[model samples]
Target: MRPVPAKAVTTSARKLADALRSGAQVVVLEVGREAGEGPEPRNSYLAGHLPGARFVSFEEDLVGPRTGSSGNSPLPRASGLQDRLRRWGVDDDSTVVVHTRQNPAVATRAWWTLRWAGVEDVRYLHGGLSGWRRIGGALDTDVPPPGAGSATVRPGSLPLLTAEEAGRLAASGHLIDARAAQAYRGDPDRTGTGHIPGAHSIPGADNFTGGELRDAAALTALYAAHLDGDEVGAYCGGGVSATTTVLALASLGVEAALYPGSWSAWITDPTRPIATGARPCGRTAAERPSAG
Candidate 1:
């Protein structure tokens, strides 16, 4: 692999297309939430996607138990992700490139999870599927048979912080709240979510200017404004969007721990404090989850 401008963050559509044509062990994955009114993403992929690309399940592949105390999309068990990767044709040496539709936030989840699972190289297509189309990269409607990958896998490649550990980091280090600015400020109408105490509001969407990720220098400078020598960490409504924060930091040669249980899990326990308003501060009282 030639040197990327930064770490495992960005990949060009041309490089990916060339890699596919060269028969490199490259697997492209289309990853994200289901769009408002299309066939399911798998069906969407069947309709059109990069050649040999597969659809990744947001619920089954990357996230774990939905009912657990751990938030909406908690991190999946290591074994679950390993199996998913294998079926996608990922091996120890396979280069996995992931892309998303509207935002790279979800795809960053795949990128972060693949790297955490110890894949040698993982990347996010810079402009996502739209980028591929913009570059005139061809798409195929044919779905390949399932791949047989026997790659050994493990977790812990990337640092993960539990809800408890994240609280500690927020108090002592940099903990970024990656959600809409309104939600970060605890807009009750949006949902019953709020920032953890001592967190800085930096929506993952803000990580990108226009529709693509910000350049590494800009990213580093953006983060540098709020941080000062403390280790960095991030969390969102669930754990998924937070990986974007991790990826953005990784590009700048900074390693950010992820709080997989994020605000979702944090809100589950009434004992856990919740903070609100523009600036984060200690919680006054635990708010109850709104009844449906």
Candidate 2:
């Protein structure tokens, strides 16, 4: 198998189209939230998606069952993910591209999860379906038959953080809280309010401009102070949005660890400290104000 290019974390729609046209062994997975309420949410992929792309459910394929106390979107069991990857036709050498029509966070979650499951050469679709449409990429409603894949899954390809590790990183290194500024500041009405003590608030949405990832120079500026060649980690409500921060850092050639059982899991233990306010002392970013 050919080696994946260093830092080939994202791909453009046009590039993907050309690759597909050339008969490159690529697996496109459309990640999206399930619509409607009730026990069974409607699959969003049924509406429309990129041609030859399989639907990866936000509620099902990407995460594990919640154990009440576990974070809402717990990392899916590795064995289960391996099975799904095979069903998606992901071979050891196949390049997997994930995209979403809703929040980019959903797509990032799939990217992060696939990496965690040890699938090399996984890339997120830059600008998502809209970007594909901009290039006149076609969408289809046909669900491709189950793929015949022999890829094996080995978890821990990427860095991960436990609750204790996250706490320690916050004190000694950069532990970015990737929730909204309002949520990070402790909205009383919200369920899981406030952030981990000593964490820096850098909302995941800030990583993008007009729904696409910011340029490398802009991202570097956005995270200049925190990426001082030191340990950096990110976490959000349930580790979903935080992947955006991790993805952004990856774009800069920075490997930031992710806390999968993030704030939701943190709050499960009353002993864990929660900080409320704009920014912790000595950890303020002028570019990130609390008023957002």
Compared to the true structure, candidate 2 yields what TM-score? 0.90
Question: Residue 237 in candidate 1 has what lDDT?
Answer: 86
Q: What are the C-alpha RMSDs, in order, of all predicted structures?
A: 4.0, 5.5
List candidate 2 stretches off by more than 4 Å. Answer: 1-5, 34-44, 187-192, 281-292
Q: What is the lDDT of candidate 2?
A: 0.84
Error of 1 at 282 (Å): 6.5
Candidate 1: lDDT of 157?
81
Backbone clashes for every candidate come to 0, 0
Clashing pairs in 2: none
lDDT string for model 2 (1-292, tens) is 1122357889999999999999988999988683553344325566667889998878889889889678889999888899999999998888999988868999999999998888888898889988998999987889999999988998999899999999999999999999998888884334346787788999999998655888899998999989777799999998999999998888878888999989899989766766666875332232234553
Per-candidate Cα lDDT values, in order, are 0.79, 0.84
Cα lDDT tens digits, model 1, 1-292, are 0112445567888888888888888888888576752756576676788888888877668887777587888768888777888888888987889997766887999898888889868998888888898889888898888898866677888888888888887888788999888888875434445678888888898787644679877886778765456788899988877888888887776778888888888888777777767787634344433556
Provide TM-scores for the models.
0.90, 0.90
> Highest lDDT, which number?
2
